[model samples]
Target chain A: MKSHDSHPHYWKVFATFAKNSLIRDMTFRTNFILQCVSSVGWTLMNVGFYLILFQYTDTIGADTGWDRDKFFLFLATTWFINSIVQAFFMPNAEEFSELIRTGGLDFALLKPIDTQFLISFRKVDWSSLSNFAAGLVIAAISLWNLSARETNPMVPSIYEVALYIVFVFLGIVIMYSLMICLSATSVWLGRNQTLYNFWFYITNFSRYPMEMYNRGWGKPLYGFFTFVVPVLLVVNVPARILAKPIDPRTPSEWLLVGWAFVAACTSLLISRWVFYRALASYRSASS
Target chain B: MLTAPTWMNWKLSSWIMIFRTALEERLVYRGDFALGTLMRFLPIVTQIFLWFAIFDAIESKGENPKGLIGGFQFEEIVAYYLLTMLGRAFSSMPGLASGIAKQIREGEIKKYLIQPIDLIGFLLLNRIAHKFAYYVIATGPFALVFFLCRNFFINGMPDLLVISAFAISLLMGFLIGFFLEAAIGMIGFWFLEVSSLLFVYMLFSFFLSGHMFPLTLLPDQIEAVVNFLPFKYLAYFPAAIFLEKIPPEDLPLELAVEAAWLVFFIVVCRLAYGRGVKRYSGFGG
Candidate 1:
């Protein structure tokens, strides 16, 4: 059999998807503008709420050491990570279920390429770039504010920046795997849009720092989200790397990375297994 | 001029018809109605948990943090947020009015116009129908859960009266919101895109109306300015009434202001509809 990686058809499929996205976006200039405004407006609203909270209270978590700027930095990083996930993975998950419902998946499956890849990257929402950019601006502002307020003047080392990037990529992979796992369930369930939405809703908890839930009932719940669901690793670990330097002698940071890696791999394996299982049960709605 | 008795009877019967149709429609879509209600309440649940965590942390610090912050007890804050959430549910019906206006601009209003009813009345009825269903299924259960969890009570009969007054104010608030959205929606006839305008309006509602947080919690200068705006009538006033933060004597005057705003928006909506319909070239017909 021909190697799948060497196939020119894979590149052709990606090009077609990119071209279609460009065409669709060009047709709706007003939507693009509205989307950009919506992203910035939502970010401002969220930040405003946090600022109000911080104004009244000095500490959020068990640690009184971290201030408002650090909190804002955590939030901004989460927003950036979330926007990227929404831009890529969320659309794919949404489209996957929609395609299954509408029988659009038949056309995709018939194509001489990997059905998963074709379904996942069929269209990228260009407007999500606006959110990504807005998040970057907010993160920069937060970092500047933190620098001014920091009791301990510490600069992020090159290794820390590189590690942050790696963790962010891993977070995205984990999130994508989760989405695929959910979407794969749709092959049998047919139109599990509510389940998808519920997943998104649960993920909203990660927008704030995991430290906020460091104790009490919140601790156990946060642990589930971090270790089991692993959404917190998407933002919390990356932001922590930049904001607080952990000693390399300590094994905690390494353990977190290893856990994230395992979770990502497990989710991907489960997704593939679920997809095959659902495929076995699948009878075309049209037929 | 019409006789008072005859006019009153006609108005009463028309309202009855609208109510009956709305009730029936609500019954037809109970599942979706329940889901919509859940969606509305989810954010409140998340927020309450967050506040609970914050209060617990404060108490652990061996300081009266709650007392120090603006004389509000932790329970009072929860009550305030609950009232705010209820006001949000009631006042947000205006979004449908805007959706109707969009349909009108797109010439889809003709379909409704062909029916033996006023389009505005029909749209209003649709909104009330959904809200009625929501109230019966969603709001009732949500209120019960909140009250049970908080175990708080109104002080006296006077406070109960104030709560009643607040309910009336919320209805008025919804009408004002509806009319304002209708007026804005009519602008779709002039502008092909109104989402940005709608978003700006939503931003104003979220901030100035104190939907996200109480105006009192905001900076003093910003609070003073926002209080004068009609946005506060939609959310803050009703919430304050429920919290018994607003005195019973003030209820009548506050409701009167809300009624006046409703009337102003109604007139503006009527004028916009008149002009917008005349300019309708039926591009989407």
Candidate 2:
């Protein structure tokens, strides 16, 4: 009898898959390098654009507690989360629709490993990780500048650092769950070419400081993205944790930090339910 | 007093037939493009929120917000961005350059070479048809959004002369966008994959063309240099003209320069395509 219970060597399997992906990438060495360079180039333009904007104002908004350096740190954290999503989840999410259209997901379901695990871990686009390295350089520089502030230098505490790490991981969980749900729509819709466009529209909300959305006409968008989609916490909580010291005066920021955990867990469960439900409805179009 | 080429002697009805077929094909995919166009406006909504916060901060700082940085008021900046979106819709060639590169790489240009129809002429007609179909579907959403945001226009309307000038630049911008992308595509004859180069080109065009922000927002030194470059005509110049950023005194000269750039691109693409076709060889049927 064939054994289909589980594979104990999931990590080993992932490593091998990653190794094969590297090999495939190396086959087009110039393309891989160009991809890295182009991504970095785009990031630099964004930084430059904001640099000019900073010349006009000391902060992104009035009394939002974000200075130039803090905003850079927040921007770097945005890059960190984005790089991880684009490197790992985005490629898989893009392929998920194609698999459904081609009936490849049926074969994926028959595998010995967990369908989600096998599906998500299959390919690793290392070129996308160049942005993560770029983010790290920016983050380290921002940290140094933050510490070197003459008057009110902000050095992160151990507790803050711990919270930052945990929140970053939880942020990834929330983003992954949202992406999986979007990809699951392809099973019903068939040939989901708009996946990337929708992803871009959704992530555009999370990229800026959440404070930017707290004002007049933006209030509706702030509520919708925060409560319904919960992307606001994806970068906000961790970036804020590093950029500022914990203040007992501000209960709302603390409330957000607490909510990230709840949001992650809820999204995880909702995504699991959605994925299987979509799978149950999936009818293979390819022979 | 110049006679057109022999290929131009083809019957008008045949040209009309080709144009109609391409238009119909594009119309079949109009729903998808219309949705894509509508989704694109989401960024502008975000821009509104962003700029409002920035200007609000400036307003709190107790300065006359009318003539702040880059010579733009809060209301004008929003209107400028809205206008640039329209300019981009006109000048964006989408997959034109890369599609040409792909055709050249895959030997699909063989069909064009073997046929009596000129490759450039055929592609231009097809693109015009495609654009027609897009504007047909996109006009509704664009009209609604522009109407809603009409209050952002501090200066309500311009005279007939300015309106005519703005319309002329937009048409020229479309032709310039086409020829510029086609010239880039001709590079496929020399390189197997120009998609990466195309990506890099797009990055620069997106930045330098003032699609991201007003060219005037750049430091004065950089703005002076950028004003002379052809890139501005792509997205910036038309919108700038419409916004009355260019004074009436300089309008005629600016239009002349824009016309010169359009002619320059047309020449460059024709020359490059000719040389590329000379070296192109198809291996199999």
Candidate 3:
């Protein structure tokens, strides 16, 4: 039965956005290609930097189970999560302040569709998706090497694979939630040009293994990020599910895994609340 | 109707005026820069942890506390990273190239051409003023961070000579950094958008400048090739000198080569500006 819905079809709206973004990207085809190449080069340099470091150590931390192949998988997971954030949300987030400054948000608010959805999906940086492709290549090579290096050619169980896929999606959602909350602050702050730099500082933590932050003063940091902000789980939990299975003895690790689900739901709620709250405070700049 | 001005005095006064205005302009726009300066060093926390783990693991294997990797003992490695950060703070030209590209693309270069001011000289003054503002704001944060990481400096303080050398290298590094980026930005005269080119330059520059790791950590052949390039002077050379890695005898030669690179870049930038201005057609203001 065709029900009369008052709201605009979000899927159709999204398809239009995708089409417009593709058109925009094609208009600067050379620039789009160059950006992809540049991104790939940077990723390759990161791989090289670690490859150099690995010459001195067996793993990222002292026997923390991030042997190079596993670490590459972790890096690949980071690339995947980061690429999604960059491709889908970063351009929009960066423009959020501009929209506020130019009173574009006022027009957006008047639209029938949801403001948050409109704000977040307004543009896509297709060039950033190259990092996702690069991540796939890295993940594939590392997985092959990992299997070849193992005595029994370790194959992940279906349960582990299912959990990994779910956790990765959750990780992306947590990142998006964090990004949206940050982006929403532009409504209050007026013109937030330094958002990119500040964003980098926060998310840089998630690029590495969480176990690397397990020692000394790092303990409290680990706790703060894991529980409070949950950036620690963005890449770690999902990658860990594939790289190394959680030992039943380590109840805390298991707890962290379970809490990630709770964190995802809570983060989404908090971000939505923050977004609307920010919107309520937003005085229209347009006359 | 005061009197006839001395050329040197007039130039000096104008320079001072430019610098003062630039300083005030920076202060006016400093919404997050003061805090951003401190936040920029947040990565030092990660560096400290990562180095400690690497050293600990290596030392455990041989039961030797002072095991060397790429000619850097554990403490020296930590100190090297810190010193490189200091050097980068001095030498990094954040928006010099892209800003220049924007000016060229939008035909804002006409302002420099029509005015009495020299473009490169004006920009140099602006950059110096920028560094001055940065240091004024960042000194407290830098002092606090360095004091906290004092344990990393296991080697006793360098003699006066090395400090002087480090200071000289930093000054030279600043000049080299400015001209190198300006030269790259001058390409905007020929190309409408130089971002892709700038991106490539930045990626290679960061990697080759030894910001990621010590130059010695690279294999011998790659190290030799990298040393042949001017980039190491920007970050690695200053830090290496501060760590007293250069022998006293080789220090003079190293400084000479750095000075040579500086001269080379200044020439290239000036030449590019001349050529660019010759063919330059002003577009939309």
Local error of candidate 1 at residue B186 (angstroms): 1.8
Better of 1 and 2 by lDDT: 2
- Assign candidate 2 its CAPRI class: medium
Kindly report which residue stretches of model 1 are placed more than 4 angstroms away from their true locations once superposed. A1-6, A9-16, A245-254, B1-21, B52-71, B111-116, B151-158, B247-249, B281-285
> How well docked is model 2, in DockQ terms?
0.70
Clashing pairs in 1: none
Best by TM-score: 2
lDDT (tens digit, per residue) of candidate 2 on B1-285: 336664455546668988999899988877788888888888887787777777777767766455376878877888888888888878889899999999999999999888867889988998898888888999988898889899999798887888899999989989999999999999999998998999999888888998888888898888899888888888888888888988998999999988999999999999999999999998988
Residue B32 displacement in candidate 2 (angstroms): 2.1
Best-to-worst DockQ order: 2, 3, 1
Q: Write the per-residue lDDT of candidate 1 for residues B9-64, one digit (tens) a residue.
A: 87778878888887887688677656755655555545656665556546667576
**Native contacts recovered by candidate 1, as a share?**
0.21
- TM-scores of the candidates are 0.88, 0.96, 0.95
Best by DockQ: 2
TM-score of 2: 0.96
DockQ of each: 0.38, 0.70, 0.66
True contacts kept of each: 0.21, 0.54, 0.56
Model 1 chain B: worst 10 consecutive residues (lDDT sum): B151-160
